[model samples]
Target: MTTWDEHAAQLADTVTHPRSRWRDAIRATPRHLLVPRWWHNDLTGTLLLDGPTDPHRWMRAAYSDTTLVTRLGSLHADLAHPDDRPPWWPSSSSTLPSLIVRMFRHARPETGQNILDVGTGSGYGTALLCHRFGDQHITSVDIDPYLTATARERLADIGHKPLIAATDATGPLPDTYDRIIATVSVPRIPAPWLAALRPGGRLVTTITGTSLIIGADKTPDGGALGRVERDWAGFMGTRHGPDYPPRLMHQFPHARDQDGDDITTGRYPVLDIAEAWEVNTQLTLAVPGIETHFETDGDDRTAYLLHADGSWARAHGHWTDAPTVHQSGPRRLWDVLERIRHKLNIEGSLGLYGYRVHIEPNGRCHISQGGWTAVIE
Candidate 1:
C-alpha cells in the first residue's frame, strides 16, 4: 500500500545532514516485503504478527522507525503460533531504518568502493546498499544459513541480487572491503576483520553489551585508530552458532533474597543503567559483560546487576535516597558501579562520548577520555 512509502518518507524526515544520502533509497525500498512476519511481546507472552493476517497492524510495524523482532530465542516468527510465549531475548530483527541510515552515514562509502554488510537479518540494509553501490560491489554475510538463504530470495524478488553468504562474521571474512559496517556488536574487534580492511578503509561497529559506537580507519601498520561517536547505538551481540550463550538467570535464586556477602549504602541517587547512557558505557567498559535490570513503582526504584560468574547486586531506593546495596560473589559489583558514579561526578561528564579509540593488530582495544582510560583485553 501507499502507507509504507509514506511511512518511509516520514522516517527519512527524522534523520538529517550526512544521513540524507540514503533518503531516496529509504523511500524506494519496500520494508513490508522484507519483513512478512515478526514477533512482539508485552512481557507476559509473545505474539506473532503476520502481514497476511493483519495487514493494517503489519504495515504500521514494518514501516515505522522501530525494531521488529523477527526471531525470539530459537523460534522464528514464521513458525511461531499466536499464543506461543517465547523467551524475551530478541535473536534477530529488522533494525530501525534511521539507525541503519545513521550507520551508513558513519561509514562514508563512495560509489565504486566494495562494502561488506554484516548481520543481514531482513536484507533491508543490504537492499539499500545494493541500490546505491550496485549489486556487484556489495557482499552481505550472516551466521544463519536459513536467514541468508531467505534474505537472498527476498533481495532477488526486488530484482537486486548481491552476494549473500552464510558464514561466521567473526571468523575469516569472504573478501577485503573498503567499508565494513556491522549491525551486530562484538566483544572485541576481530583480527580477521582488521586484516581484511584495506589501508585507509573504515569500520563502523559497536562494542558488545554497551551502546558505544566506534568509527575507526585502518592504519598503515595493520591497526586502526579513531574515536567513539557522540551519539550512542547498539545491536544484538554477535551470535557464534544457532543461538547465544545461556543467560545469567540460573544464578537468580541464590541472590533473590539474602544479606549477601557485602552490604553498603550507595553514594549517589539510584541509577537506572538502561536510561543513563554515559554511565552505562563507562560501567560496561570498567566491568565488561555486566547485565542490568531496572524497574520502578511510584517513588521507589529497584535495580539488579548480574554477571555470568555468580556475581550479583540488588539495590532498592527512592528518589534522592541512598540505596541499600546487597552484593555477593568473587567481585564486589556495587563497589565498581559506585566508583564509576564518583568518577562521573568529579569529571563534569563521563567523557565516554567522543573518546579516542585505538585498536591494535593483536585485537586489544584502548579507549581514553581526559585522564580516565579503559582497555579491553
Candidate 2:
C-alpha cells in the first residue's frame, strides 16, 4: 500500500490556494488516522462510510478534502464495531478542507499568537492550527466532553498538546486570546467571545441566519469592533448539549399539516441556496426569520419561503395557468425574493457581500451593506 500520502497530495493540489500554509497542513496530516470510522446519512438513519467491500474508495474518501461526520446526538459513529451499522443525524464533523482554509484566511492569525478554536470537531483543524503555530499557542473548546476528549487524544497522538475545554463556547473562555475563530455559526457574536480578545485582537465568526463572515477587532473597553460580510463562510449552529433542538416543524403547529396551501407545485428544484449567495444574503437581510425550501416533482416544481410572521409563499411553475402562486398572512414572500434577486441582477451584486460587521459592549451587533443597515440582537 502506498498509504494515503500519494492521494492526499493529489487532493491538496486541487485546493484553490495550493501554496497556502493551511494546504500544507491538509497534505501533511493523515486525515484517515484522525477519523478512522465515520458516518453517512441514509433515508432512515446514518451508516458508516466504509467497510471491507472496497478498500481503495474508502482510502480515497478518507483522505480527500471531503467532510465526514463522526458524532450525532450522543452517539459516536466512529465507535460502531465493524458489525454494527447505526443511523444518526450529523452533530459534529471534520469540516471540508476548503472551508477550513477559508476560515484561516479570514482569521489572519499572526505568527505565534494565541488562538481559541470553537467546536473542535474532529481535531483536524486543531492539528493544522498547532502545526502552523506551536502546541502552547492553541486552545480548543467544545460543549461535549466526549468531543473534547477525543480531540485532545488525537492531538496527543499527533505529538501536540493544546488546552481543551469541555464547555459551551457561547460563554466566557478561561483565557483571553489574540485570535478567536469559531467553526460553528452563531446567532450573534457572543459577548464573551468579544471580551476574551486582547486589545486589537480578532474574532472570526459566521452569523447563523445568514452565513455572513464577520471579522472584528478588540477595543480597550472590554467591548470589541469589527465588520461582517467580507467573506463567505457557514457552519451548523453552535449546539449546547448532546442533542440539538428539534426542527421548527416540531415547535410550530402550522409548520406541518397546515391548511394554507398543500397543493403547491414548485418552480425550482431544492436549489442549493449556497449557489445563490447574492439572493440568499439579500433576502436574509430583508426577512430575518424566513427559511426557504424548494422541491421538484418532475415537471411540477415548487418553491416555499416561510417566515415567523405567519407569512408564506408557494409558487408552482410549469402550470397551464402560468405557475399558480398562493400567499397568505402579513408579508409576501415571493415578492420579497423577486425584489432581492432583481436588485442583485440590476446592480450586478448584492451589497450584503460588501457589508461590515460591527460589535459593541452591550452585545449590540449591526450590519451595513449598500447604504442599507440593520441591527441584530
Candidate 3:
C-alpha cells in the first residue's frame, strides 16, 4: 500500500515542477486526513464516498488534483446519507491542489510575513501555508463554525495550530496582515479587507461572477492599483451566511422550452460561456448577474441566458450560422449581449484582462484600460 505521504509527493510532482518552492510543503501535507469524506457525481445522483468504507477510492480522490465537494448548499458530506443527493450546487470544497499552488504563485509571499487565509474550507491550503511560514504567522478564517472547527481539529492533528476563526470574511477581520489571499470571490473589494492590509501589502483574489484574477498592492493613499492577471481562475463567491443568496431560477419557468416575446437572428456566432473564457469574462463584467447554460448536439448548438427581474434569452443554431434568438421580459438580454459582442468585434478584444484596476477606500472598483472605463459601486 502506498502511504499518504508518498501519495502527496506524487500529487505534488503532477501539479508542481521540481524547482518549485511549494513542492516540499505539498509533499508533507496529508490531504486525505482533511477530506475524509466527499461527494462524487453518479449516474443516479451524487454518491457519498466515505474514506472508511472504501479506502482505495478515497485515496485516489484525495491524492488527485481535483476538487472534492465537501459541502453542497448547506449539507455537509460528513452528515449526508448514502441515498441523499443535494440539489443545490457546491457551497464548499477542498479546491484543486494545482489551483491552490497557482494562487500562491501569484501572491509571491515573502518569508516571515503575516498572512490571512480567507475561506478556509478544508484547511488544506492553510496547512500548506502553515508549513511554509510557521503557524504563528498564519491566520485562517471561514464563515461556518462547523467548517472552521473541522479544519482546526484536522490541522492540529497534522502538527499545525494556526488561528482558525469563524466569521464573515466580508466584515471586519480579527487582525491586520501583510498579505490577504482569498480563495473565494467577492463582487467588489471589501472595504474592511483594505483597512486590514498594511502599507505595501498585496492582495490576490478573483472578481465575483468573472474569472478575472486581481493582484493589487496597497498604496499610501489607502487605495490599491493593479492590473488583472493574465491567467483566469474562479471560485464560489463569498457568502455572508451559511448559503448563498437566492438564484435567478425563478425565471426558468417562463423561459424554459418556451417561445419568447421577441424573436430574431443573432448577429454573432453561438458561444458556450463555459468554453469561451474571454467572452464569458467580459459578458459577466458587462452584465453582472446574468445566468448561463449551454449544450450542443451534432452541428446544432443551444444557449440560454437568464437574469433576475424577469429577463431571459435563448439562442439556437448550427455551426457558422446566425442563431435564432428568443428574448422576453423587461430587458432584452440577447440585445445586451449582442452589443457587447459588437464592441468586441470592433475593438478586436474587450481588454478585460488588460484593464487597470483601482480599488478605492470605500471598495468602489474602477476598471479602465486604453479609452474604455467601467465602475462598480
lDDT of 2 by residue, 37-65 (tens): 67776665656665345667677777777
Model 1: per-residue Cα lDDT over 159-260, one tens digit each: 789999999999999999999999999999989889999989999999987888999999999989999988779799898999987777555866657888
Worst 10 residues of 2 by lDDT: 262-271
TM-score of 2: 0.85
- Alpha-carbon shift of residue 74 in model 2 (angstroms): 4.7
Local accuracy of candidate 3 as per-residue lDDT tens digits, 197-305 = 9999988999887888988889888889888887789899999898977666554866657899999999987888756666777777777777888878899998888
Model 2, residue 29: displacement in angstroms?
A: 1.4
The superposed Cα distance between candidate 2 and the true structure at residue 44, in angstroms, equals 10
For model 2, the superposed segments whose C-alpha errors exceed 4 Å read 16-19, 41-46, 51-55, 72-74, 80-89, 251-275, 308-310, 319-322, 329-331
All models, RMSD in angstroms: 2.1, 3.5, 2.1
Query: Candidate 1 vs candidate 2: which has greater TM-score?
Result: 1
Which candidate order results from sorting by TM-score in descending order? 1, 3, 2
Error of 1 at 197 (Å): 0.7
